[model samples]
Target: MRTLRFLLQKEFRQILRSRSLLISIILGPVIQLTLLPLAANFEVKKIAVAVVDHDHSTYSNKLIAKIYASKYFSGGTYHSSYEAANKMIEQNKADIILEIPQGFERNLVREGHEEVYVAVNAINGTKAGVGSGYLGAIVADFNQDVRLQWNQPGHFSEAPTIDVVNANWYNPFMSYFLFMVPGLIVSLLTGIGAFSASLNIVKEKEIGTIEQINVTPIKKHHFILGKLIPYWVLSMFVFTIGMLVSRFAYGIVPVGNIGLLYGFLSAYLITLLGAGLLISTYSDTQQQAVSLAFFFVLVFNMISGVFTSIDSMPDWGKALSYLSPMSHFAAVMRMVVLKGSTFHDIQPHFIAIIILGIVFNTWAVLNYRKTT
Candidate 1:
């Protein structure tokens, strides 16, 4: 216990004495917690619309009003002709173009049907889909309202109609910030653990302190442990801060067992520390360690689905993600944050991490040697 405390205190002191460590530890989490959530959302809004009304009647004007009133669409520009609206769409000024044919109200009143043209930009497929749905919904509602006014018996018919009681489960209303903050936290922790931890040790070796340590009574394992304990503690601290920020900024509450989370996180940090140690062991200079760590971290962050969905990735890319700790961590984090999955629900992932931790730690230790 005494030795452990001494080691912890010494490591803390060493970390504090280094300005770079202090900045990365503090600013890294802050930037991730504050900025990344805003940048990683998929929600569509404020789509520009254009209107072509040849009818010049109250019905055409009302239809245009309906489109503009939709929360999904911004106010539309009035075009005298479809050709004019088409130019606006082609110029990227309009996301959707609507055209009501001439004599639309006359056709609706006499024949009970009128045609409306809707042209959408297919370049952004998802947004175009959403915009099409919005336009369709508005027109459908208007049709129902017209039916009630014109065809209803005293406008109070109680017929069996299919009413959709749409309810969103789990992350209801889909707060994008809540979805992204946790993933950013994982990315930041991996960067700090993989980069900063190795940098300090490699610097020591470059400056000849490692040579003196080799002649001391300390074993290779003990020396590595002593070096890693500080960053392990720092990583845990950063995670706690991230959780607090999640609750306050994103209103994200963890539904999983907190004990299980911390337990797995403990093992996860060991794996990350092993990676840092492995880099330090192989690197003769701090520059090499930093460059190699940066490359690996970038690859891991991209493949891990930090900003994108892993489900969208190809089978081979998804399968290769097993090699990345961030991939596993991001999955578990999102599972806990959104789905409220139990440890039992994540057992396979947990077991995989355990095996990976053992393998990385063993490799790091084997690469580590003491020379007198």
Candidate 2:
């Protein structure tokens, strides 16, 4: 205990003395939590549209008005010819071109059917898909309105309708920030914990201080724990700051027990820090530790379901994602924060993280040589 305490003191002193590290530890989360949510939007809006109205009738103008009124669409450009609209799309000035053909209103009124050609710029697939969907919805709504206006007394007896009241359980408003902030917090915390722990021993090696501690009577476990403890405490502090920023900046408060979230985070950090120590044990210099840590962090972020859904990944990729500590942490965070998941709900992830911590820390211990 006494030896561990002294080592912890030394590590904290070193961390506090480094101005750059201190600033990063304090400012990095604030900046990311504040700025990332604004740009991480998944809901496509303000899609640029081009319209070619050949009919130019009252119905056609009403349809164009409906498209312009939608929040999803930007004010559309009116082109005289389909060729002109194609040119606009080629120039990247428009994402979609809606062409209302001649006799569109006449066919709808007289023949009960008409076709409107829609051409989309598929270069940005997500934008194209979302914009097209929004346009289709508007046209459907306009068709319904036309039917209601044309209905005579007792002619259309309120066509049977099945209203789908879509209930978004976790995020009712579908706020992108609600979905993204927690994942970002988990990812950033993982990187900070892993990078700091990985760099600790290697930094000592670079500065020629490892020889001094190695000659002491301290056990290997004590040295490892001492290295782990300070960063663990610092990471918890950073996590708290991140949570506060999430609350104030994005109105995100964990729907579950705060204690449960902290419990999962504790285990997740242990696994990440152990990986860092493993990197430190293998690396002889700070540069080598950084490169290795960056590599692991990048892989973890890519597979962790932060930017994309794990369910959408291939079977092999899903199986491989379980190997990443960030994957477990990201899942647990979303479950607890958004869904109000309990300990029982997150038991599998908790157990997985604990096993990872044990495996990684054991490997790091075996790799650490007092004499080397």
- What's the TM-score of each model vs. the native? 0.88, 0.97
Off-target runs (Cα >4 Å) in candidate 1 are: 1-9, 153-164
lDDT of each: 0.82, 0.91
lDDT of 2 by residue, 274-294 (tens): 999999999988899999999
Tell me the lDDT of candidate 1: 0.82
lDDT score for residue 14 of model 2: 88
In candidate 1 the C-alpha lDDT for residue 89 amounts to: 86
RMSD of each: 3.0, 1.4
Backbone clashes in model 1, listed as residue pairs = none
lDDT of 2 at 189: 93
Model 1 reaches what TM-score against the true structure?
A: 0.88
Of candidate 1, the 10-residue stretch with the lowest lDDT total is: 1-10
Cα lDDT of model 1 by residue, 189-258, tens digit: 8988888777867887989987877787766667777888888888899888888887887777887776
